[model samples]
Target: MDARASAIAVRDESCVGDEFAPDIPGLKARRFWIRNSGCVIAAALLVTLSSTALLEPLSDVAPPTGPEQKKPVVLARTRRQSVTSPKKARLWMPRTGRPETLDLVERMGDGSMSQTSYFDISLDLNENASGSAASSASAVAQVADTGANPFDLVLQDALDARQLMRHSGLGYAADAPKAVRPADQSNVTVTPAQEAMLVRRIVSLPVQPERLRDIKGVIGVSEQDFAQLASGLGGDVVRKGEQLDLIIGQRPAQPNLSEILFARHLAADGRERLLARCDDGHFQLVTDHRPYDRMVAEALAHQAAEARSGSAQAVPKDVAALQDAAADYPKLIEHLARRNVPVKVSLQIVQLLRANGIHWSKTADVPQLDFVFRTAEQGEQELVSVTLKGKGRDRRFYRYVSDSGKPEFFDDAGRSVSKTLMHKPVSAGQLGDGFGWRVHPILRTRKFHNGVDYRAPMGSPIVAAGDGVVVKIDSETGYGKYIRIQHDGGYTTTYAHIEGTPKGLRVGDHVAQGQVIAYVGSTGLSTGPHLYYELRVGDTYKDPTKAEMPAGTTLRGRALEEFRQQIGRVETIASTIRATATSAAHSAVSALTPGSDKQ
Candidate 1:
């Protein structure tokens, strides 16, 4: 400090060198230095504090730098408040379960119009347990708050909520599902019964069999769940009141009393549900569970098993699988025709047809099973019919037998053999005694009897042997009651032991081969109710089996022409198998029932 002060005094001319001195002295210099030191220290502190305060605020307000930033998370849309409708909407049921969406532009309470999306839902009222809704493009579709009560509950009507839910123990008010959501929306609940009904409805195909061939898959159930619905399969099923009830499973609170009306559609669910009764229901919607058609086939298979038990006569010894359209249909049908189905299941079979001179008979494999019905309407005609199990579209139908006589094989010199023989004279037949020298049961003597005795039940029908005119109608003690008919060529035939004369016939009446002649009975010298049939040529008796009569049935003139046309129609139907769709499965058996209207 002393050197710096001496140098500063020498340089400054105002100082006047070191020999001169100031009048104020050292006190003024000390006072100036104290003030300068205070100003410098205060300035430094002010600069540090100001910088720190500015920096603290900048650090908080500034955008984050580097890798710390992240994208924001989106949240679920809040459900809207419920709205009450002013009046009831139209109530109607939808025929099909096709999905639909509605965009509604509604006016709010404050007069502002708002657009909303409404999804259709279906719920089972009998169920009280929780389930899910059918899905859509987003979760919002599932969670949208319903705008109205959804049901036009006219509680003032005789139908209370409990009555509306059917007789289910679940009262409509407390247990039945409503469109209104709870404050905390939990999963919808369903009962086992509701679920079973749902599955049954989905599996039920339309009345047409062709439509059933390709069934749509079930939506809400699993394979195992759908299978368990066949409760009657494992247990006995009985018709209780109006319903087919199962021995297993809990009985409904009240027996379900309903009928199938063609006018209104009813299903395993309620009798008939209208959209006006309730808007939409929520199910824990399941989708694409399993093969629907296969399950139906399985159900049908099970039904067949039940049928087999009751109808020992109708079911074939060899339970033939349904052969695709082929000779097999005729063969299977022939087999089925021989037996009778139980009345309950008879309608399930689609058809019954008769294969007459076409050679179902005289063939070893194909049984001669002719189920005929007598009609009093048309002079007592007989109709023998069989069924066709029209399989797939394939043309290779199966054969009942291998050695049947075809026209090509029977042709001689490009012309077929002589016309075929007439049908058996008696309704029930098989040669009990041949036309040879044998011990006659009544006479007990060996002699030639030129006729065959057809074994038959009492009061059995006897048809004319061929197209012929009545030659004689005689009642003798030896022949009991007999009718002789003169046929084409010099051939003639006689029916003996007839209980009564054929109805609506006289001496001059020309008769067809299948015309009813008489009823079988033990009228005279006979062992039991049997038809003693004898064939003759030019007044000389011959073996009935060896005798040949007219063919193509015993029709004549206009009647013969009509028969030919009917056969042609039958042949056309036989050829075009699967392509034909008929609603006559029920119609086929309806005629057999007592109260059924004639088909």
Candidate 2:
């Protein structure tokens, strides 16, 4: 369109509202009249705009609408079961930190439990409904002597539980239902609102045995010695005074007393005896005497006289006969070897057999004997060449077959398979501290330590015991910068005093076995930058060395058999710690616990 026509269209739209525009072409002529139409349109538009502006002030004075509505209301219910027989029941909920009040219900034998119809007991912190300070004091007084709570529930944490019971007085031990056992009489004497929970009576041996029978020649012997001997014999030592009680049931009876006295058979003489009787009722074998040999000898001599008419063919001195005789022999030949035997005669006997035809057989992987002696003196020099086959199970028994289908024997102490057993990854480090009661360097008195302390340099990689979840990671009062991993089988372990913890590591993170989680550090209450390690069963701290560590699950079936057999050979390696007794074993085992170099 021409400029004149465009100008006219714009003027017409701007002036009146463009309602008068024609849709047809040739608007060019209209442009020429656009300038003329502009003045006319401006005057008309001014009148219209002036009228709207004048009327706008009147529109602002109108009235308002109703007030804002509130949100819709909906009634909902939250349901919770209450504890039935609240007044009569004495319940205990065990946990750490805050104690939660739970509604307890009693379950019947059929798996149905009694429920509270509708009753909620509200606890008021203020006023008389609140537990009294005097009641708290009384609960403390009651539990102080027992070392446990009277509510039949011990706080998962004993000390913390006692403090809560003392301060809150939330439980009524006096109201506990009558004890179901003989000790229930004590419950009736409990005072009201008092911590009347039943405390497990400490089991102890009576002050003395009522009957003091006339006895003589029985002297107290070391229980450890007895235990060691019993273990070597694959039997347990139950100690009586100077004598250990032997429990010999009839597995298979020996030929006679002569068979046992001569160490020809290991079959029992058919008797079982309880060893020692202690004040704590804890009995162990008394390994102070060799009563078995003498008893068997006497019994054998009597039986021999009666059977003198029978064919007393010369017994082929074989390993089986020796094993039978030594089964009831009180002299612990095996224990003596491990703990330094003083018997020179036994050593000479062993040397003679080992140097002679008694060579180790490759077939059974055990030593064999091929000589028989008519006299104990000839045992040192006699050499009757005859092939014999057998497997050495102990120092007394070598079950083997002779060339003539007859079992032959020797009087040599058989070596044990377990004697050569050694634990894997032998660690070569000093044991700094052990788990259990020790004087706290900071506390200045005895305290229960839940873990072990390993002395190592900083930045040492701390390995995970097994695959587990990192449940906790924090620096606490005594434990500085600790990491806890929850493993399977209710096992949990902690590694503390870590330096340079890996990034992105946090709680709920899964870790694999042998994964490096952190480095050693002196972060918390440590004496130096060493690793402090702990093993917990559920929440109870246990001696890491004593606690059964989870071995690789892959080592099962044939793998486990091989592993066990391998360890059998491994245990024979002498521990780095000086072998003394109990303390030495603890020290040796501690080297394998966490945070220490176990290799």
Per residue, candidate 1 scores C-alpha lDDT tens digits across 1-599 of 49898557534523243245455556346545655676999999999988877787766344446778756545566543323335443322221111111222222335443332221212221123111121111111111122111112121133332342232222223344545467545444434333211111111212112111121121222233223322212321111111110111111242232111111112334343111101121112122212221222222222223223432221231122212111323433322222221211221121222112232222242322212121121222222123211222211111111111211111111111123345477757766888877888888988788888888998888888665688888899878988888875567788898888766778877776577888888887888888898888886888877664443223346644543543443333232111111111122112223333321
List ranges where model 2 is wrong by over 4 Å. 1-430, 551-599
Over 112-155, each residue of candidate 2 has an lDDT whose tens digit, in order, gives 32321110111111212213333333333332333321112112
- 10 residues in a row with least lDDT, candidate 2: 210-219
User: Weakest 10 consecutive residues, lDDT, candidate 1?
Assistant: 394-403
Which regions in candidate 1 have their CA more than 4 angstroms from the true location? Answer: 1-482, 486-492, 496-505, 508-532, 536-542, 545-599
lDDT of each: 0.38, 0.38
The alpha-carbon lDDT assigned to residue 65 of candidate 1 equals: 64
lDDT of model 2 at position 250: 15
